[model samples]
Target: MIEARRLHILRAVADHGTVTSAAAALYLTPSAVSQQLSALEQETGHRLVERSARGVRLTPAGEILLSHTHVVLAQLERAEAELAAYSSGASGTVTVTSFATGIGLVVAPALAVLADTAAGIRVRVRDAEGDASLPMVLDRQTDIAVAVEYRGAPGADDPRLTRVPLYAEPFDAVLPLAHPLAAAPRVPLSDLSGDTWIGPFPGNPCHDVVVLACEHAGFQPTLEHLSDDFRAVVALASAGVGVALVPRSALRGMDLTDVVVRPVDGIAPTRRVFAAVRCGAEEHPLIRPVLDALGKVAG
Candidate 1:
């Protein structure tokens, strides 16, 4: 069988245009390179190189073999490089799952940074809402997941997840521009008492927070609209549909032309942003970099 080392010698000779230069590049003696080339010729039953006083050149068969060798060697080099990067936590495909707003505001930018900084890393992101993203990490279906929860919300105790704090985005009042309370420097929960409320879709942590905030402020929230998407809620608020309580991060990209965001006067409802991976796989090569990226974006 033809050895790759012998092939290497032939390839090197062709690359350097001479056996002496090939030997110099390999840090091997010219005699050693000559022996390998001779052995390769015997193995292939063809003349691979013609040596002259000046140097050497490939014959017709040698040129064809060299063309094929170029592809094979390049592939092998790439495989080695990819394996090294995978081992070093520098590169690999990272499967990430995140909620809608988080993807647009946070994960997408972080991934863009990762693409620019880290080579051979391919990120595949799935847009899964809230706790739904947790299962992707827990089931090992994703390398990392960004999930959100209000302080007292259920399902924060997943033993299979190794959670990292990303951020705690404070909730703010989103009011229509024409509303009396919209001009306030800080809108109190009491200010929204009679206003129709735009709440998150039922069962979402943000939805519960909005309702509980209203009730704590001495009134039962009159939910005039329900939207899981913060942007949609903002759009509705801008259109005078209703006021909403939303996390600041979720509102970052929304155009508030007909709407205004103000700090809630009394109680500040915040949603905890967490980066989670499968518990035991905390040592995963691709996990830390993504987590680091998320942390950077959060900050």
Candidate 2:
């Protein structure tokens, strides 16, 4: 069966005339968008697109599929609009799971907004890591999960859940105050290649983030000390043992006494945070308001 999500991707390519442009509009990598288009072609057993030096154009098969894609997407939107109206007066609880920083940064403030403006909605917040929270949403343990992009996260086209992007935060380099480059306005990640590293353990999501960041800087980090808690990581750096890459959000609660924070030179590694709900629940009246509130504060 053809996935509706792929149809949307097809429509994006058709409208934009190139894979790169479509990927940008969809907030996806160009490679990911191409993979989806390829899967779409395989499912239909026809070549859907013709790529050339200038850009891309649809083949006859692609044209036919795109024509129907419009009708299908329109119907889906209509269905969502009607459902929104049906649940217009909805009043109930929205249970949410998020990491500690997420709870402090967005969730709690959003709850305050709901108390005043969305009296019909009541939100219950729980502290859960992003990896654990995603499964909780799938198992129906929570209505929503504030999650970070991770190694095994559900793809954008996953049918069981709806992904709403929240924001992306960068990882900053933390070094001992007495380190040679500690006072530099922005530290090159590669500059710390020779330094011992302090970071989260292997299974933690932050661990993958740190590893990826270091790899992007052209070298692997030598994790001399390990701690998942950002505070502990910073404390280790402050103790002048090693350096670490900590997310900007996690650093908010740190005591920074003998440590210096610097942005990574060139591009910093970033993690994308998003909200996930069971498929079709995003439009629910009560849940929609909370998502809106979250967006407002996340801004």
Candidate 3:
């Protein structure tokens, strides 16, 4: 029977155009290279190489064997990589970029839960606002990206990405302890005309949504502060810096001592959260668990 080792040596000889060159390249003595090729030829019952003026040339059979060897080597490498990834807690690390609320309220919590459950899973998180996260994900800087968009604000341009709608949460106007609106179960848009507003600054999805919602509410807001940090936004809302528009998911189980979230009246402001991955790698073994974990946490 022909051995894979012998086949590999023959392929090297075919590639290098001479047994001496192949032997040197493989760190094998010329004699060993010749012996392996000789054994391979004998096992196959065929003449695989012919002497040339300079060195040697592969016969038709040798050419075919060389081609098969490449296929076999590639298959073997893929198998090894797959097994290693599976054994090492899906060993490849997933670098994730997340929107503020998603990081604090969703991804961070899920990763903590996964650490306790999945031994082979590893995660790296980055604070990426919605606008920058998409390009980072498409450029492969981040393995997964969590972002926010209005129902149709993602635009019509579809790049090479796999988008999953994780969840959508209603937007609420957050009030401070002394605000008169704090006593109302939910504030209507008509009541927001004269109030100061807290918003994520420029280029933030929440900021954009806050702008659009206010326009729909018959008045543009007087922006008091622009904050991308959800913790800071919460602190501002708690300090009565200004009333902020917040996603329900951000407050779902969080404790806000001085802040109250009331549904905005007349306009049901909602932000759609999405998770994106590289198109081809969306099915990678490490990706499914993380996506499933998001679903679990979002639920």
Candidate 4:
């Protein structure tokens, strides 16, 4: 019989498209991954992969096995979830991943509540961005991921995962105290058409949001400064270098001495944050309580 663990390794390899990448995802060495793949081939009596200079390609046999692998793994996940539900108490560790601001706004508070109420459940947290967090959950790297609605994120009805809506937060304009619009009750995105913008790097989800927001307002921002850290973005605005738009949660516990924040007047740019878990494991006893805690905190 083929081992379930070997099938898992194969699925990882197939998903990642390289032995090295699969090994990194599984926290194993490439040599270990190769050995497991070899063992799996021997057990199945089929040449599963064709290795080439570029990368390994799945053979017909490998493709056939991969189809079965998904079903087997999902069934196993369902079995584990059911078993956990029937267990006397929720006493296992639940790993979670979230972006920086969500960590402060949601995960941290949820963790605090879990510690006080569900003492038996141990929680491990990893800081990952929205783009990476949901994939981490799909890869079984984390039990839950706090993610945001970003360009290229998986849809809400993605079959492999279950998404739970958390919060919808608007991005506020940050400007220097000395700026002309600093005292305005609200700032329009078009008003900053000529202002030098400080924003996240181009590929970042937040950067995409800012760009889309600006496009909707009929102008493209002249991004003079790039930063992933929202606090630093606000600080740059305060220094009179450039203006920025930052999420509300990012300002928590920050000192905004010379920076003024105001909502956008017409089209408010907002991000929706949510939680994702493996589709079949959402009802796991330990996971359910953590989800509850997160919902309470978000509420």
Candidate 5:
């Protein structure tokens, strides 16, 4: 029932020993200070001060309230100091979830960046695919989600999320080194119509992209191998099990001795990467820098 601001006024009067002195200390008019003191007394239903021409003094009731006010004011000061630290993004923890490749490409590098720059921020990372991660952000399970664009995914205009585009990477064609077209600089999707495909499973965003791209190229792919790992996809292609379209980012730093990676000719099947947070949360001091760091690393 007691207001923090009025408690502050009460503490000031007790400190200054008079309404007029407290008013000067607070930059408030004497009447304004007096009115706030009256309201505080009424709110507590206790005669908090005794006034005389000499000045003002606390009644025993006032003395007790003043004692409590000291502790309350100290706590209020601490809360204000913490709020200012949080508002400036100087210290906090932020949780992030992303698919494996995204973690490697963006989140990992981002952490390194924040370490050197915003050392006060601690980030917790989770590995989750776009389908799983997007919903996590929507439901408040995480502070940020680095995800891929996929079927049934929320659109940019979705009121629940604020999407920040990180990058779009083409799905490079992976072929057996001995395959007939392996030597080509780039291969058209239609040219591989007869080949067995190695791809992510049905529900994956990459799977939808590959299937749609193949359909646009005028044939539905015959997928004979499935795995979410790009390394496995490349291994399968290298062993002559099937050909695949793996994201360029996922291919980073892997040995490709047995398989050849080529760009998809004309209209490549690409994965659009982004970071998402609950609507209006993108401005959070800790979260915003993480997003910016992710974008910087992805770029």
Candidate 6:
């Protein structure tokens, strides 16, 4: 019989393209991962991995096994979910992961709601970006992830996870109070073509959103300052450093004293936030209440 844990390790290796990366994702050491892979090969009587100077590649048999691994893992999750539903009250902890602003905007508020209503349930939160959260959910490190949609994110129907839509928020142009465009009811991104921009660092999803929006507006933004913190990005704009485009939700509760935020006139760039769970665990007793609370807060 093939051990599900070894199959999980194989899937991780395939997903990340390296045993070392898979180990990191699984919170195991490289040697441990290698040992598990070797054991799995002995059990299956198949060569599943090809090692080269560059890295490891999956053999055709490995690819086939990986496909089955996904289905088996999801089914196991379903069995666990069903068993949890039968066992007792929804009275355990649920681990959640989200980006920084999402913690403030959605997850925190949902925690309050859950505390008032489902006091038996507790939540532990981790601050992670969209890129990291989905994998965490798949690995069962997080029960649910409040993640944003980025270019490479899995689609809504991905078999490995289930995505529940929370909100779609637009990016607002933030300008210094003294800037001429600050007074406009709506700012065209093209109008800021010549202005210096403050934005998130490259490789961040928000950074890509801003860059793609600017490219659509006919010019690449001159990014003079980069920060992952939306609050810092807005603060920099307030200090007359440069203009910025920040998600509307991120601006909540911030003191915009010297900043002017206006909607973009055309093709407003927006980020879609959602909750993701392992494919078959969306309705797990402990997870369902939290997902409901988050949906309520998002609404």
How do the predictions measure up, each by TM-score?
A: 0.64, 0.70, 0.62, 0.85, 0.70, 0.94
lDDT tens digits, residue span 1-299, model 1: 87867766786687568888778767789999988888888889999888789899999989888777745654554465456556785666888898877887789999878877665678899987665666455334577888877534335464335678887877899988898987789988977788898988776767767777788888987898987877788999989988889988777756877888999997687777788875545445465677778888888
Q: Which consecutive 10 residues in model 4 have the weakest lDDT in total?
A: 153-162
- Model 4 residue 244 lDDT? 92
Ten residues in a row with the worst lDDT in model 3?
151-160
lDDT computed for candidate 3: 0.76
**Per-residue CA lDDT of candidate 5, range 20-77, in tens?**
8778767789999999989989999999999999889989998888777756655654
Which is the winner by TM-score between candidate 4 and candidate 5?
4
Per-residue lDDT tens digits for candidate 6, residues 1-299, read: 89999999998888778889899989999999999999999999999999887778899999889889879998998888889989965899999999998998889999999999899999999999988888888766889999988878889877788889999999999999999988899999999999999999886788889999999999999999999998899899999999999999889889999899999998899998999998888888899999999999999
Q: Runs in model 4 with CA error above 4 Å?
A: 1-3, 34-69
Per-candidate RMSD, Å:
20.0, 10.0, 15.5, 2.8, 18.6, 1.6
Candidate 1 has its poorest 10 consecutive residues by lDDT at: 151-160
Better model by lDDT: candidate 1 vs candidate 6: 6
User: What is the Cα root-mean-square deviation between model 2 and the actual structure?
Assistant: 10.0
Please give the distance, in angstroms, between residue 267's alpha carbon in candidate 1 and its true position after superposition.
3.2
**Which pairs of residues clash in candidate 2, taking residues 3 or more apart in a chain or in different chains?**
none
**Native-referenced Cα lDDT, model 6:** 0.91
Clashing pairs in 5: none
TM-score of 1: 0.64
Cα miss at 114, model 6 (Å)?
1.7
lDDT value for model 1? 0.76
Tell me the tens digit of each residue's lDDT in model 3 across 1-299.
66868866776676568888878767789999888888888999989999787988999988787777756654543565466556753755778898767897779888977787675778999998877787566444687888888433344244345677788878888888888889898798667778887777877788878788888878989987877766677788899878888877767666689888788876588888888875545556677678778878877
Residue 18 deviation, candidate 5, in Å? Answer: 63
Better of 2 and 6 by lDDT: 6
Compute the lDDT for candidate 2.
0.85
